[model samples]
Target chain A: MSQAAAAPLPPSHREPRTERGRRTHRAILDAAAHEFGTRGYHDTGITHITARAGVALGSFYTWFESKEAVFRALVADLSAQVRDHVGPHVAAAPDGLAAEEAGLAHFLAFARQQKLIYRIIDEAEFVAPDAFRAHYETTAARILTRLQAAAAKGEIRADVSEAHAWAIMGMNVFLGLRYGIWDDSAATTAVAQTANSMLRDGLKP
Target chain B: MSQAAAAPLPPSHREPRTERGRRTHRAILDAAAHEFGTRGYHDTGITHITARAGVALGSFYTWFESKEAVFRALVADLSAQVRDHVGPHVAAAPDGLAAEEAGLAHFLAFARQQKLIYRIIDEAEFVAPDAFRAHYETTAARILTRLQAAAAKGEIRADVSEAHAWAIMGMNVFLGLRYGIWDDSAATTAVAQTANSMLRDGLKP
Candidate 1:
């Protein structure tokens, strides 16, 4: 997460208003996503975001304290969707692969809506690490908990230990990265389908 | 990779080099890994690095150029290990899981060695979009080639396609992130062993 929103440059100034303020805030965020998505977080600037958003420098501060703040918000929003998609379905899965696919669906949907945020969370390690690590640990724990619950209920396979559960969670995250977030090439659909199929069938003899 | 490393804030003054220069360079990079592993890329700075390295500001320039330069160098150095490991092995596998596991082992070793880089790569969607996409595409293509080669050899199952190979590759990358990079704590050796077993076996019924 960036403390500054736009890379190293000062975020542009903007006029304040309740409705317009919210609008400007959202625009700045969306622009930040675009910049982060296109130009990259490190390469992007606050000025770039405000310019894209058609806002003033002052307006950025009014909305987000820093790029990191906006980034956190971005991750929080996406995680919320992931949480929505994952929280229940994962708990309901009857097997390891089933659990994984349900969780993957959440991540895929999250990636579609919050590609920027997901990107940040995914890349939090490089740019804003503490925050990213925090998010990952939290998210991993949640998914693990759900898996544990399923295990308890005899829904998730009992043979899959808690630790292996995390690896399964890792698979879910990586699958989303391949299929949803980095699907820019449009050739990943088959990969997604087959991998998902493998997930359902169990990848062994 | 980052362009010429952003020159960090200049030292208050310049200093001459000695044998300590090599030692300090090593120290700086070691410190850099520690810093990057813990703090992330953006939050860390030359000042932080130098402080950790116990070298003066000017010394940073002697070894490398910018924080990003260090990062690139770090990632490059790490890639050497990754390349050495996975780069050569995927070519050797005679069958599906064998090919995947050969690649997976290399990825796991890389993650274990440079956990931060894998974390960053996984998160490239947000932190460094261009680089992440580049790596993703390049890696996918590389795996696709291997799959094609296997196809030529008649080693690949007729059921698996080029895209499925790429998704398998994606699964390997994700496995590294989920188990190796995301804090070795949450998961366990049993989980890894089991997952790796499945990774080699896959969910193919």
Candidate 2:
């Protein structure tokens, strides 16, 4: 561990001014995703990230002050990545429930391709506790917003609240872990449809 | 880090034979839970565990061989603790959905009291991957069996499968994190009842 890593610093203290600087910053983050995703936080080093990014040590310092900063940034980046990847698919759905199904299906697909997303995000609970909480809080809040919109449109129950959003988010997260990360043998659409059915119609006999 | 911790040993390779021995073993595990739960795995040492347990160095070795062994055992122990804590509440419910409601309510209470549980279990993902997997796998399997039983009893849809089980487990987990670990301001029974309503009836208005 580097001495710089010991002192906590703001993750995004510096931003790229030009295209070349932006490219270098992006490369460093992408490389960080791979290294932190694979080697984990304790084992991974700034040199490992720089080596993988093919950037100079000075370039890393210019962008990120320490290992912790890059990791915190990566957590936020991955959180945004999930939102970007699934947002459009969700928006395309005709109704709120359908939007959920679509969001889950796309999330499963994203998890399969970007398997490291789970590891990176999960580790944030310890490495960057605030970021971890923010990710779920943001995701659940988004779900709540969608649910409220659906309720206003008379598409779903009028009593939709924060708890409902949390429940749905939890269901989607675990389903992604089981079908997406643990095994890809199961069809994503089929899994989504099954869960969506339960969401669409109660599990009554 | 001790050299003994480097070698992988069966978590339960040595079992206490006498009453006195069993008490000593239990004390060590309880102490380990506190140390590992608070300090985390890498930061904790054997002496830390022994001192906390009020046992001598030899007493620590009498039951477990290394730090890794105790940590693995702790994962399994915590997993069992959750099951033992929540099982009766679930079983005592009159119906399938009600059982889920009861399970969540009790689980929330358990999380609030044993706050260290989330940290220890979450850390197991990196420290003891297999044990972490086993914990969820076993919990999901139990949920599946309950769903199947409920289906047979005409309490739920006939098609309740592993997917449904995973979805419910996910809901409970995230709900626990939000309402249980993060903030206990919300009444657990209220959260469980709201979630149960969704499971009992579809989200449709």
Candidate 3:
């Protein structure tokens, strides 16, 4: 526990101008993700993140005012990572259904490599409630937008709503947890294909 | 804050035989749920639980050896609570898809009352790793069994698999978090109904 944990962090951290400074910022955020993901938010400290990133204490303060600020940034960064990783696959799909399957497949693959995403995002519910809510809310909103677009394009059901978006998001998240984080014995594509079928035809006999 | 946080607890707690003992045990557990749910496992103390239950220190130790024991028990208890609450509704539904709808509706309703359930169960991942894994594994297993039975009965798609069960479970959970815990502006029936429509017929246009 550092003094940083006790104080309120600034709304945002300093934006690094130089390439070297940007790399240091990225390194700190990456290390914070691992530290917070593995040890949890409360148990992780500023010093630990600095040590993990191989950066000095003063350098940390230059980018992040406190542990909380870095954590907030990490949540945003991870959320972006999921989007950036899945977005291309989704964009390449020919239809809404294929887009969803591609999204799930890419997400599961991403989850396998970054198992800490679940932990850090979940812990944000306790440590950073706003960030936690924003992450899911933003994600759900994006799903809703896509579903509506697909509906307009006649690529999906006409009755797509926020509830449907939440449902699909939930399905993807839980599947990722079970297959992606808990165990990877099952093929990622197989799992995605199974869930995608349900998303396509549902459980109708 | 107590030594109990660091010390290893006995594997299991003593079972109460007498009626009075059972009553006391139940009270302690209820109090423990509130304390752990509100304050978190690491921050919560046995004294807080005892104080909340209005039971003496000795009474707390009578049924549970340490804070860890009670936390583990609470995890199991909450898991059972979800099952017990959702089971009757699921059983009463006329068909497999209807059963899932009923189950999700009931779960959302249950989550509204037991809002802290997500916090406590999720925190178990860090505080009690085995308990956390067991909670989800058991839930997913039960879901798979039901889905398989429905498939055999020709109620749902014949190709239903464990992946389908996990997907459905995930949908119910995220929907619960959003509609159940985050906000109650939307009707539970409406939320469940919308998601159920997707389960009955997916997003195909």
Candidate 4:
């Protein structure tokens, strides 16, 4: 998760005042994820989102000001969703290495279910650069914290640092892309176990 | 390092038959790298590439059919460039693990010098999907070959598999983005050494 707590809608986004409004807000964001993920930022429009959301044009404006605003929000939403979905699995693990394995396995499962995730997040690089950077930065920071805590308890090496966190994040991200998004032939647990062993024992003969 | 040998220009591309033509072809590709790298595929034009290359309008057509064609070719060209540039350094290392270290170190330097590389390659995911997939698939395949060879020699664990190769590639790629593209403050060798150490000894206390 990001160092910042899960924030409510930012200033640019108008916070829904009632349960109905909140449902509308959530609907639009989910619809935006599908439209943007399928049609891409350039091809997707506010009407596309509104149409898919089954919300009135006025409702989209009630929450988001523009196509860019919604896209940015969706990126953050997806980032948070990944963290929330995988955080529990990671916390349930027996140790640091097992936590990583669980995190990766859960992530792969999430990616498989939400295939549009890769497209939307990848598109953020061009559509919203700050969100893209923040997503990775915060994700790496969270991983760093976990590794440091693990090291402190002697669960892993004492020299764990930010680079190691980034390395692990990289591993999980690519593995998710290959085994989760591209092809589902490989078993998620099997993949996670293979990667976990490498982390646990290195490659030394 | 693709399983297939570095190929001559595919049929879509007109291979220059003479030295002067070859120079023109090379110039056009380098110019495409800069133009597409900067302006991106949608914003860049054939005229822009030709203008940057300082080649005649006819010469652009002689080498490439359209902007999309050139972008596809550029992805392949950059892929080959990375393989060729990093291959020698990897080969010069004494063993499998050290070779990965050298490969990463050299890649960081290369990414620093060619900062446009990340932008172009990332954009290819949307602009030219096949080429983008080919770049990574071939790269992972090459890594798998190295790991299998190392395992056979008793330099690394015999259980090394395709998953291990993807994990390593992911590590190098993300590390390169963080230390190489995002910030230059970190020492490349130090970062590579840190990551290499994890691969060498795992994270056990």
RMSD of each: 9.1, 5.6, 5.7, 2.8
Q: Please give the fraction of native interface contacts (Cα pairs under 8 Å between A and B) kept by each candidate.
A: 0.32, 0.92, 0.95, 0.92
In model 3 chain B, which range of ten residues has the least summed lDDT?
B1-10
- The CAPRI quality class of candidate 1 comes to incorrect
Identify the runs in model 4 with alpha carbons over 4 angstroms from their true place.
A1-11, B1-10
Candidate 4 docking class: medium
> Which tens-of-lDDT digit does each residue in B1-205 have in candidate 4?
2334323335567878999999999999999999988888899999999999999999999988988899988998898999999999998889999989999999999999888898999999999876787888888888999988888999988999989999999999999888898887888999999999999989888
Question: Compared with the true structure, what per-residue lDDT tens digits does model 2 show for residues B1-205?
Answer: 1223323435553888999998988999999999999999999999999999999999988888889889888877777888999999989999988888899999999999989999998998899887777778878888999999999999999999889999999999999999998888899999999998998897999
- Which scores greater on DockQ, model 2 or model 3? 3
Residue B51 of model 2, lDDT score: 98
Q: Give a tens-digit lDDT track for model 2, residues A1-205.
A: 1223323334464788999999998999999999999999999999999999999999999988889989988887888899999999999999999999999999999999999999999999999887788788878888999999999999999999999999999999999988999888899999999999999897888
TM-scores, all models, native as reference: 0.60, 0.93, 0.93, 0.95
User: Where does candidate 4 clash, by residue pair?
Assistant: none
Write down the lDDT of every candidate, Cα atoms only.
Answer: 0.59, 0.89, 0.88, 0.89
Candidate DockQ values, in order, are 0.21, 0.54, 0.56, 0.67
Better of 2 and 4 by DockQ: 4
* CAPRI level of candidate 2: medium
